[model samples]
Target: MEMLTLECPYCGVQADETELHAGGEAHLTRFGPGSSDADFEAYLFMRENPKGVHFERWRHVNGCGKWFHAARCTMTLEVFGTYPAQTAEPPKKIRDAITAKRPGWTWRELS
Candidate 1:
């Protein structure tokens, strides 16, 4: 199996893929009880899987055991930046970098 590495923003640890776990798309707002069926459904299954800049969640499972968010390009597989998982939106620096690389990119607070 090919090996990969992801840096943990919280602990500053560089861990191999085996030491990390993917948590899926990041910055997802929870659709709790009482949410409309449509909202729940969207939360359960909807994802852009966008071809360009994408935000994702990951954990340093075998290392710091902390979760963090990563902004990466789905096409090029290049990571633009990583930030704490608790953040509700992409950091400004990361957004700027993405804009610089992918001109005319639209950034959404909840996408």
Candidate 2:
């Protein structure tokens, strides 16, 4: 799939489609022992296909080579913001933007 121009948050480089690689969903915690099959399936395959706020991972393959998280709207394909992949959750600004755009929407705290 063709990717759009992505700006690297770490190095401040605007990477073209060819310079970046799309990673799958971010912030996934691996299921361990004592977990049921359904739970494992949810972690490995079942993903959120929401029409509103979504978060994804991107790698600046040909530029900074750092992984970052991008928050975007699935319906509009509008990018809200991006940040380092090491973060545990979406930044406050991104959350605020999404909340403003999608009134009454609240982010669920992942267990």
Candidate 3:
């Protein structure tokens, strides 16, 4: 049987690809509603041409429904780290709001 290797960022596990799912290219950030034609063209056609240190968004499609981030060296196919999907900047505002609501909760204390 052919086996593919994948590294899980959330749990810091490196296992067969059967345990994960490739969620397609990760560089698709948001575009404003008023973006011009060039913006649309770039979003649709130009993204994720990486040689090294690429941040990819993937899901533990088989193990967990949660999405996570992966830092990979594309040239050598080496995965550096994986972190929970919430770590991606898209959720920063929400995370900040939640953090702000938690009175007297310091990051140092949590750690």
Top model by TM-score, which number? 1
Give the alpha carbon lDDT tens digit for every residue of 1-111 in model 1: 445567799898877778889999888778989999999998999876788788889989998899998888877777788889878899889888888888777535533
Q: Where is model 2 poorest over a 10-residue stretch in terms of lDDT?
A: 102-111
**lDDT leaderboard ranking:** 1, 2, 3
- Which 10-residue window in model 3 sums to the lowest lDDT? 102-111
User: How far in Å is the alpha carbon of 96 misplaced in model 1?
Assistant: 0.7
Question: 22-84, model 3: which lDDT tens digit per residue?
Answer: 775554655668899888787777756556545567777777456776655566665545556
Looking at candidate 1, the ten consecutive residues that score lowest on lDDT are 102-111
Q: Name the candidate, 2 or 3, with the larger TM-score value.
A: 2
TM-scores, one per candidate: 0.87, 0.80, 0.61
Residue 7, candidate 3: alpha-carbon lDDT: 64
Candidate 2 residues 1-111, lDDT tens each?
Answer: 544566689998877768888887777777878899988988889777677777889999887789998877767667777889888788788788777777676444531
Candidate 2 vs. true structure, TM-score = 0.80
- Candidate 2: give the clashing pairs: none
TM-score of 3: 0.61
Candidate 2 steric clashes: 0
* Candidate 1 regions with alpha-carbon error over 4 angstroms: 1-4, 107-111
Error of 3 at 53 (Å): 2.2
